[model samples]
Target chain A: MKLKGYRRPDGRIGIRNHVLVLPCSLCASETARFTASLVDGAVYIPNQGGCAMVKKDLEITLEVLSGLAANPNVYGTVIIGNNCEGVQASLLAEKIREKTNKPLETVVIREAGGTIKAVELASRYAAQMSREAGMLEKEAFDISELILGTECGGSDPTSGLAANPVLGKVSDKLVELGATVILSETSELVGTEEVLAPRCKDEATKEKLLRIIRENEAHFERAGESLRFGNPSPGNKEGGLTTLEEKSLGCIHKAGESTIMDVYGYGEMIHSKGLVVMDTPGQDIASIAAMVAGGAQLVIFTTGRGTPTGNGIVPVIKITGNAETAQLMADNIDFDASSAITEGRDMEELAEGLFELAVQTVNGQKTKAESLGFNDMSLARECNFC
Target chain B: MYGCVKLHEKDTVATAILPITSGEEVHYRFGGQELTVKACTDVPVYHKLALVDLKKGDVVTKYGQKIGYALQDIPKGAHVHTHNLYSTMPKEASTQEE
Candidate 1:
């Protein structure tokens, strides 16, 4: 199917054209936010770390920041930084340049003489980028150019029975049309790893899936705990889930029945087509952030209870199967799959409707979360900072 | 109308599509036969209900996967929840029963 999108200079297609005002360190976040607020179509990401991060944490932060700048949705970036921070504005700008030939400008608070001067300089750059971005006309792109991310949060029985199965159907249709699907949340996959691993395209891929699951289990074991302690969270139990295994079974339904293609680490760019897995924690914001950083232009989130999480650049389409939650949280939810349970809506028909809505979203429809300005973001931390 | 959704043919438990009260006759299709079970206790919406008689220590299956174990002998129509079923895995001390 053909859909309208913005074609990036790097040959990638994006559903949204946004000028980003990015902070390179925590010290520059306020300046970045002020700069973005001044521009008509600019979005800013708050940097929560960068001053004293250890080697691994610093590397991950740099990758996530650069990835955000290079994401196809971003038309251009104005990076703001404190001159003496661990991550320099110039270095971050260079990293983004290495990935894409898009427009990039930098402002250092120290070099610009203070936060006021930095915001002023950065806002001017952001405004110019926003104007330039606004000038680009939308072009038609094939479905193959799209990378779709799947996630489930605030789950209940309906999640597995209705919402997730509906998502699975949509996921299958997208993969059949040659789009890439990213299934994440390694912690949620603990008990179902054996069931999912065999679906990998090759032995190596299968082994990688198994290894990640084992490592996740070991991570908890090392701390004298079990994954079950947190897998079926308090909300999950209240929603009627009992164990990690049961939750995993329900969670895996979001991937549909597609063959697993490749496995990637958190925030790693995905280049393969078909269904791939990203090793991410079960925390909703961090998991979605990794997928967005990995180049997913759109995300389909299934929630039995409901969530209002949305990414700054990529649009999050929230789907819920709980009939009551859908009606009660009408302002937060995007699609209601409750008909499958209450009104006996066919799974395939519900999936087709969802697919159509996704196309419409890609063609410029605003999701409920986007309209509400729910720009939630979080970077995955591997360990404590030094 | 109140109903229950059985996700898979192999599942021994079904989820309530709506709140079911004690003595309400809930009908479901099982193994190509239409069957009815009277709710022995109130089953809130989204909670589980036993589809068959379950003895203590019996594994309860939903979504065709193990969800928990029956903590007491449960009749076919009994409500299945923390009161009658508990997680087989070690529980987190932080998650006290609500």
Candidate 2:
């Protein structure tokens, strides 16, 4: 597919050229937001975990924050921090710099002396970065530069039967074209270890995939909890999903039939090509956030019940296979694969059309999530929100 | 025309593509062969229709994997769902009772 994108100095390509106003912690979010508000092309995300986090949570939080700045979708970042947070602005800036040579500037609210002063200083940096961002001419890029993230939410029978299978075909096609595809949602992929393990290219990769799935399950087991309790969520039940197995059986179909190349920790930068897995929570927002941090420039989300999840830095294209949902949630859904069920349409033909849509999305076509101005994001934590 | 879809050749149940009423003859593709069965009960869209009779305790299969276990005798063409089947996996501490 012919496309135009920003080739980052780190040798990654971005479909979107966004100047990011990053808050290292929640205390600096307002400052970052106001800074972004002044710059027409700048964007900011709500940073809820930058301060006073427990050990593991703090580590995951830093990975996510730095990963966001490192994401290919972002052209540059202006980091803002409250002076005494668990994650310091200087440290976060240093972390991001370790990942890329993108334009970066930092401001500490306390050092600036107040919110107003912080906003003023950061806005100047963001404005300059946004201006510099606009100066780069679009150069030709292709699918090989894409690290496509796949997800499913509010799923039902048709997701397993139609939508996800259709997406599987797309995943295979993208992998065949030499692009990287990330499959996540570790909590929901329980029984599929046997299904996914043999497909791994090496024993180390298979072990990583197995260990991640086991650890995700152990997290709940140690809490005196069961994945089945809230999973096949009430919405899932109403949508006809019965058990975690049933839901997972439907979920893994998104990965298609590709050899698993590598397994990544949540929000860890991806270096492997072709099919890989990211250890993310089943929560769609958090899962998408991890993939974005891992450098996914775009996400293709399949849903049987339809969802409006989006990210500030990435475009989430929603697809569904329920004809009724396709019409009822037409405002949210980007592609409808219901024809695969109702008419038993050709899966390959449907996948080709979806790929064409993905190519268009890369070349600047806005998805339903993007058009709706949705910027929802959440981080997967090992402990309490603190 | 298929009224239901059997995802894998070994699946004992097929998912209804459209709502089906009792006494309706449902046609579905099993493997490469088109098979027909009478719906003994109504099947909601996206719900399962039994392609073969199930005695109590029989394991329910979909995508050729064990999905759950039957709670009661399920005749061919009957709607299969939570009411007549139960998940074998662990449930929440308090909601373990059926």
- Estimate TM-scores for all models: 0.85, 0.87
Clashing pairs in 1: none
- Per-residue error for A235 in candidate 2, Å, reads 9.4
True contacts kept of 1: 0.38
User: What does candidate 1's lDDT look like per residue over A301-321, in tens digits?
Assistant: 999889888989999999998
Range of the 10 consecutive residues with the lowest summed lDDT in candidate 2 chain A: A236-245
lDDT (C-alpha, whole model) for all candidates:
0.84, 0.85
Model 1 C-alpha lDDT per residue in residues B1-98, reported as the tens digit of each score: 43777766678888877788998998654434556778888888777889899999998887666776788899988888767776644443323252
Tens digits of lDDT, candidate 2, B1-98: 77988776578888888889999998765434657889999998878889999999998888667777788999999998778877766443211244
A305 in model 1: Cα distance from truth in Å?
2.6
Q: Which ten residues in a row have the lowest lDDT in candidate 1 chain A?
A: A377-386
Residue A367, candidate 2: Cα error in Å is 1.0
Candidate 2 per-residue C-alpha lDDT over A198-311 given as tens digits, one digit per residue, 9 for 90 to 100 = 889999999999899788878878877766466666766665666566667788878787899999999999998899999999888999999999999999999988888888
